[model samples]
Target: MPRDHSHDPGHHHGHAHSHGPATPHPAQPAPWSILRMTVTARLAAALAVSAGLWVVVLVAMR
Candidate 1:
């Protein structure tokens, strides 16, 4: 008689088992959310300033 190895705890048959839909964490901003927002705002402001300067130079050159 051969022992069945499929049900062995140490065997991994590359099968996925879904517990259920993932549950969302508590409604709270991530620790880095503020830093991300600040960096985004700074980048946007820098781009806006750069565009304004380029427009000024172009208009002056014309």
Candidate 2:
């Protein structure tokens, strides 16, 4: 689709576009509930993978 480049002479090109919503700070840890849940999920996934690999090794040793 072609963008409309049509402009009115009344529209000033000198206008600045410096306005937007503020984002959350990266340094700040997320909410306790959210952070705790995320950590739990990651740890669970890690432990699951480790256990799976360990089982594979054990079965191979047999």
Candidate 3:
């Protein structure tokens, strides 16, 4: 007597299973824009502090 493998319940024959559609990823900001914004903010802060210190030195010398 020969045994049959086609009727096995635990057998998988290279069939693909689906898990629904994937969500879209969010858009990213441009690298140059981000870098320019950061540098501009830092430069503004540095200039403000330098001007403040120069004003203080001038007031002290009076």
Candidate 4:
């Protein structure tokens, strides 16, 4: 019968592994930062652009 080394702490699996939260690789883009615009600011800008588009459409329809 083969011995079970899977449960042995001293066993080596010849593979890399982690036991905690995975970290982002250095090549990946950083997460959002405080320096970026806030949700409210983004919403306001989107609304402004939408309003401008609506105005253009209304004028074009005339």
The C-alpha RMSD of each candidate to the native structure, in angstroms, is 12.4, 10.2, 18.5, 11.6
Q: Worst ten-residue run, lDDT, model 2?
A: 17-26
lDDT of each: 0.76, 0.71, 0.75, 0.78
Clashes of each: 0, 0, 0, 0
Number of the top lDDT candidate: 4
> Per-residue lDDT of 1-62 in model 2, one digit per residue for the tens?
97565575456568554543275434655565535567778799789999999999999999
lDDT of 4 by residue, 1-62 (tens): 99988889778779665543376534547596545979898888889999999999999999
Across 1-62, the per-residue lDDT of candidate 1 in tens digits comes to: 99999888678768654443375544666676535677778899789999999999999999
Candidate 2: residue 13 lDDT (0-100):
65
Question: Can you write out model 3's per-residue Cα lDDT over 1-62, one digit (the tens) per residue?
Answer: 99888868766668744443374545667765535667778799789999999999999999
Instruction: Give the clashing residue pairs of candidate 2, or none.
Output: none
Clashing pairs in 4: none
Provide TM-scores for the models: 0.41, 0.41, 0.40, 0.44
Candidate 3: residue pairs that collide: none
Off by over 4 Å in 3: 1-37
By TM-score, who's the top model here? 4
Whose lDDT is higher: candidate 1's or candidate 4's? 4
lDDT, candidate 4, residue 21? 32
